[model samples]
Target: MKKWLKYSLISLVILLLIGTSWFTYTFFIKEYETADENVDNIVDTDFEVELPDTLEGDLLDKNESTDKNVNQSKNESTKNQNSQGNNKETSTRNKEQRDTENDNSKSTNSKTQTKDNNKETKNQTSNKNELTKENDNDDQTVNNSPDESTNSEEESEKTQQDHVTAEDIKNRYRPTFQALQDQALAKLNNLVAYAYSEYKKKKENGEKVSYGYFYKKYKSAAKELEAKTDATFERLYTSLQQDLVENGYSKDEASDVKAYYNQKKDERESRMLSKVLDKF
Candidate 1:
């Protein structure tokens, strides 16, 4: 039994030695592989550290560009603000200049208007003074003419007597007839002057004064005169006839006065026409 036990112990001892050897070999191989893996990781980490410098350079360039852009934007904004300020100042100055010019023009226009008004007022006053002076001279002339004054007094006395006899006729027949007569005389004088001027023109032109030409001109002038004189005579005779009738005159007496006045007017017109024709 002892011999068997000794053999068994030897076998166990040898087997245990062999197992320890195998375990130690496996641990050494695993440690070597782990150390290699750690070396490779350290090399990779060193390479990544080298790339960080290039990345830092790119980041610095970008930062510099961004700062430059920010400074340029600020400079441009300041320039724009200054330009706007200058434009505003110029516009203000122009507005002030326009206002000043407008004010000056208004002042000049006001002065011109004032001067024109003064001139017009002076002219109106001068015209009024001249009219007053002319009226005074006419009154003085009327008062100084002895024959005219005597005739006027006689006419006034006759008018007063007629008023007593026919108040209605006196009231209706005013001195407007004298104005009418004066106007008619002025027209007659103008007609005579015009005829004389025409005759002078005909002589100057060396035109022949044939009987046919003279008759034609005379007839034309007579027709025009008749048209004007007939209207005047009708108006005056109608008014006179109306007055006479209203003054209690008989219709026959009113008709007689109208007829006589018409006859006298016709005779006067005929004589005037004859004189005008003879002159032509």
Candidate 2:
């Protein structure tokens, strides 16, 4: 090979090498600068989003207002709950006070009724004592009379006549006395029948009938029957006494007849009361 040709070939190869290096450096440097600019833009946009000062102030004010509204709503709810609790406490207190007042009123009423009953009973006792005193005074006046000796003689004679004529008086007046007794027994039967019916009605209605209550009712009825019969006997005795005096019987004998019939009435009343109350 020629020296000149070799040298020319080497120079051409060196020129080609220099052109490739320059092209590579220019292309790589431009691409790297573009990538760095893109990274900087992403960092600014994604990591630190900044607003204008006026917009930021408006957002801060809106957040503070929302927090204040929430606090106000919570406070209002708490106040309402406290008010309801206070109202319930007041209502309970009022109810308790009313109950206490009612109880006190009932106690006072019961006491008043007791006082009235006691006063009435005292008055009745005083009246009965006065009546008994008057009766005793009248008996004393009769005993101290001027004709006392004559009355004693007459009473002794009448007693002797009463002993002799007792059976005759009974035979003459027994039918009338028996009729009166029958009427009294009929009245007692009516009362007993009514009371028994009431007792049966109470039992059928599922009411509890206490023995004491029924006994008291029957006892009261018996007392009423006795009182009414005693009054009737007194009236009948007065009429019979007049008839006996007209028929030549002594006053003492007529009085003995009255006494005997009165004893029979008492026995009948006691027996009827015991039987009726026992059935109840």
**Top lDDT hit:** 2
lDDT of each: 0.53, 0.59
List the candidates' TM-scores in order. Answer: 0.32, 0.36
Using alpha carbons, what is the TM-score of model 2?
A: 0.36
10 residues in a row with least lDDT, candidate 2: 43-52
Per-residue lDDT of candidate 2, residues 24-130 (tens digit): 55443223212223222322221111211322344356546555655565565556556655655665576567557655665777666776656655765676577
For residues 1-280, what per-residue lDDT tens digits would candidate 1 score against the true structure? 9999999999999999998886655443223212223222322221111101222344356556555655565565556556655655665576567557655665778766776656655765676577556556645654445444345545554554454343344333334444444445445555566556656877899985444443344344445554655565556556655555654564454454445546756765776777776775
Name the lDDT of candidate 2.
0.59
Residue-pair clashes per candidate, as listed? Answer: 0, 0
Displacement of residue 189 (Cα, Å) in model 2 is 2.5
